[model samples]
Target: MAHSSNDEFFAKLVELFDYRKGKDHGSIVLTQKRLTYDQPLPEATSDTILPDLHPPQPMPILIRATNAKGKEKRRAKEKVKLSTVVDADNLPAFFERYAEVCKVGMNTLKPRDRRRKGKAKKKKGGAAAVGGP
Candidate 1:
């Protein structure tokens, strides 16, 4: 049995995606693949004030599950959409869940090229950058 309620399911979804910022219009906009910063976003448990993406995928997003539905099943058709918007408060949990669904284990994601955006700083500088120095 699915133990999660509708609200719980949706809440987790929001968390997995991080609220960041979305359009204020009544509908949420779906993005085409935005080349990820090519770096894994900072993890959620950071003691810092804000998190990059709750679930963190090292690669750019090719698709959002909410926007994953389509007539061809594998191809995204224009008329397909599973969700339009998510609540901001639920962002934390949803982003995690989505990462899991996508199999983004801590060390499993492939390293992506980040030089296009003017050279992404790698943390080989150590945890110091994340406040650990």
Candidate 2:
């Protein structure tokens, strides 16, 4: 990309990852041959582990920065494709890992209190601004 931020971009990525942590996954019916007892998505069992859902991440965005020196620094952007580039068989492992992350709780990965403080500040300032000086 045009190389502007490190923390901002990584923070965005972490947020994206957290959102994906509790991914809602649907299971495929392998044996449609009919079962005797009913089979709904099982509740959390002692042995079974349901991992979080995190789709394979896309490649980083590529940016082109024009104007070598001086004030005018216009930038053009190019979006890269979001493809897993992995074999179909190996995809199952990804799902399994996601489930594990879900089991562990996604909140742990969040950036912590700074986000909340920022929101609170914005709300306070926004309210005052909306009301008066």
Candidate 3:
């Protein structure tokens, strides 16, 4: 198949699987014939999708601070190494300070919790009971 055709097919497949449970769209292994458009159109399978070999783990953040002064006669100071896990609640604050200190944006920070919207539903009778006795 032509490159464009392959791209279009991939897009459709992604759209189809985007909301499907237990589906991974990353890292596909296309058959040689499919790539070359040879006879007997190649088939696609979930074989390309591998389970998460390494589960998510929190990594630490490191910060270093230094102060120095003047010519031949000089003074230098260092601060303790600090570490933190990046999370939704704290990420914006972390980045704000990080940018100020490092002068570089660290895009590697992953959200500890996925973005969630809206309030959770209350139990059926819990609200009514709370106002009584």
Assess each prediction's global lDDT (C-alpha) against the native. 0.42, 0.36, 0.32
Per-model TM against the reference:
0.24, 0.19, 0.20
lDDT at position 82, candidate 3: 21
Q: Which segments of model 1 are wrong by more than 4 Å?
A: 1-80, 104-133
Off by over 4 Å in 3: 1-55, 68-89, 100-133
Give candidate 1's total backbone clashes.
Answer: 13
Cα lDDT tens digits, model 3, 11-62, are 4334323323244322222221111112232244375343233223322232
lDDT of 2 by residue, 108-129 (tens): 4435335656666779865664
lDDT of 3 at 43: 42
Write one digit per residue (lDDT tens) for candidate 1, span 93-132.
Answer: 7566655644432233347645543433454443353464
Q: Please report how far candidate 3 places residue 35 from its true position, in Å.
A: 43
Model 2 misplaced regions, further than 4 Å: 1-15, 18-83, 108-133
lDDT, model 1, position 122: 51
Clashing pairs in 3: none
Scored by lDDT, model 3 comes in at 0.32
In candidate 1, residue 9 scores what lDDT? Answer: 46
